[model samples]
Target: MEYIDPHLHMVSRTTDDYETLARMGCVAISEPAFWAGFDRGSVESFRDYFRQLTDFEPKRAAQYGISHYTWLCINAKEAENVTLSREVIAMIPEFLDAKNVLGIGEIGLNKNTRNEATIFLEHLDLAVKYNQQILIHTPHLEDKYQGTRMILDMLMGDSRINRSRVLVDHVEEHTIEHVLENGFWAGMTLYPVSKCTPQRAVDMIERYGPERLMANSAGDWGPSKPTAIPDLIMEMKKRGHSKELIRRVVYENPKTFFSQSKPFVHG
Candidate 1:
């Protein structure tokens, strides 16, 4: 079954990974700006990275017949530098009009610090002013719960935010309901380690019934799998899920959420 991995860092993967993804039925993907394993020192570094995301990565994905969409932001980990974060956020608009550009995102709390929250709200303001959709990254492991709540509260406090246009990703059993019940879309990122596994993702699907929910591999430079969504598809089938139901979560749900972005043209 053809599908879309809504969140993956192709910049960290090889060309072989792209070929493998295409072979496994990944028709398209959306890559959000994330920390490049370290804190960048200047706004120029981010400017160059945005150019790579908007200009270079799309061309690379096209070589394998995979459409690439991207989100632009400084990422939460780097948000600690308030001055640098603001500079990067101000520079993001230059790429917002790019055909493959989606919006300002993967922009939530990391350690849930004051600076991160300030930057998160600033990114929110940028998205609202530009009428763009958002993709958020909640903190990991022990920090996930409180970080997710902090991110949710900030979003809820904003009257200008259109709930349907925002996606809070990396949700687990503990945080999924909070995201969906409040009317925003939720993304379950399947990973080999740390995040939800294929079986667990299927369980969440069973419990939630698939409305406003989607799954992704979130393949990055770490120990992750680019084909984890296919793993979820296989697990769903093994558990006797109908093909239509599987298709809705893996394919249709992402399409529906992304269609809200002007740059995303459904094929």
Candidate 2:
């Protein structure tokens, strides 16, 4: 069963991740901008980071028959430092025109604080200006329910953004309805900890029924493995989900979401 991980952070992963993912029938992935596990001190840092995403990783992924796609935006946790976030946002256009760039993403509130919200709105404005698809990373743990609500509200208030073009990610049982109810695409993160696990991801599918949904392995600077995409695929199969269901959730949904950025991919 071929799959696409709609979200990942390949820049922080090793080549072995590519090999394992390819062997698991992974065909494509979308990576969102995320914290580098430390504070990046300069705009040049982000520029280089985007370069790595567009240039370095794609070549490595090609070796394993996996296509690498990325979303360029300043992560919300780091957005607390507004100045740095703006600088990173400014540098996004240069990379957005790269061949593999999907859109502006993984940008949303982390601590669910006011400043992070402001930065998230700014990021949304940038995405709208470009007519780009958005990938949002909502808060986790205790903050998730409210943060997911806030993220959806912000998008709804923005007359310029279509709810269908936004992917509210890392949703769980509690937040899934809110995302789907608003007609926005939902993304489940299959991680070892601090997010939904593979079993729960499949359960969510069973409970909610898939539509505008995608799953990803938010593998990154932490204890992450890129194989989480295939992990969920396996779980879905074990749960007796049909091939069409898996295809719609993993491959077709992501393709349709990212294809909205076709101009960016060619520009």
Query: Which candidate has the top score in TM-score?
Result: 1
Query: Which 10 consecutive residues of model 2 have the lowest summed lDDT?
Result: 258-267
Stretches of candidate 1 exceeding 4 Å from the true structure: none
54-128 per-residue lDDT for model 2 (tens digits): 899889988998888888888888899998888778778877678887789889988899889999999988998
lDDT (10s digit) by residue, model 1, range 1-267: 999999999999999999999999999999999999989999999999999999999999999999999999999999999999999999999999999988888899989999999999999999999999999999999999999999999999999999999999999999999999999999999987689999999999999989999999999999999999999999999999999999999999999999999899857
* CA lDDT for candidate 1: 0.95
Question: Compared to the true structure, candidate 2 yields what TM-score?
Answer: 0.95
TM-score of each: 0.99, 0.95
lDDT of each: 0.95, 0.85
Error of 1 at 70 (Å): 0.2
Q: Which ranges in model 2 have alpha carbons more than 4 Å from their true place?
A: 263-267
Error of 1 at 107 (Å): 0.3
Candidate 2's displacement at residue 190, Å, is 0.7
Best by lDDT: 1
At residue 133, give the lDDT of candidate 2.
88
